[model samples]
Target: MSKQKRNTHSPELKAKVALEAVRGLKTANEIAQEFGVHPVQVGQWKKALLADSASLFDKKRGPKPKPEYQSDEKLYGEIGRLKMELDWLKKKSGINLP
Candidate 1:
């Protein structure tokens, strides 16, 4: 027999189902049936969801996100290109006059 392909759920859907699972609205088997997936998958999602949620409330949060900056090589390359274009324009148009 051929293998069965399972449908992938989005992060939002997973969170929703996990939240529902946390709320004790229905059994894992029922939720699995509702979402057309297996009970074990829902159980795993619920476990992960709770773990991450608990982390958010934990006192020891990690360091703040670092600011991303442009690389020096890229900036220098852009500056070089601009300077070359300016020089080319100066050669073609002559010096700036009063």
Candidate 2:
């Protein structure tokens, strides 16, 4: 038996096919045939498109806030702790660091 190559569809094509299916003018089988994909796949795409459609407009209009790694006070405290540790180590080793 010969192996059949799988077909890969682009996002644009998926959106087009799913939109056509959503229109309900033609059945899933017809859309699948036209797009050379399975009817179930067409249905799934339609469902996904409908489900995610709401999220398309759910985004708020504004500049997104930047992520903060740590607060300024916390970073300064850590730096102070590190300096204290370094000074103790230098004093213990009799190495005077100016």
Cα error, candidate 1, residue 82 (Å):
24
CA lDDT, candidate 2, residue 88: 93
- The digit string of per-residue lDDT tens for model 2 on 1-98 reads 99999899999999999999999999999999998999999999999999999999989989876557556678889999999999999989999878
Give the Å error, residue 44, model 1: 0.4
lDDT string, candidate 1, 4-91, tens digits = 9878889998987888788898999999888877899889999999889877767666886554565667788999999999888888
Best by lDDT: 2
The candidate 2 region of ten consecutive residues with least summed lDDT is 64-73
Off by over 4 Å in 1: 1-6, 57-98
Each prediction's TM-score against the native? 0.52, 0.66
The RMSD of every model to the true structure, in order and in angstroms, is 6.1, 4.2
lDDT of each: 0.85, 0.94
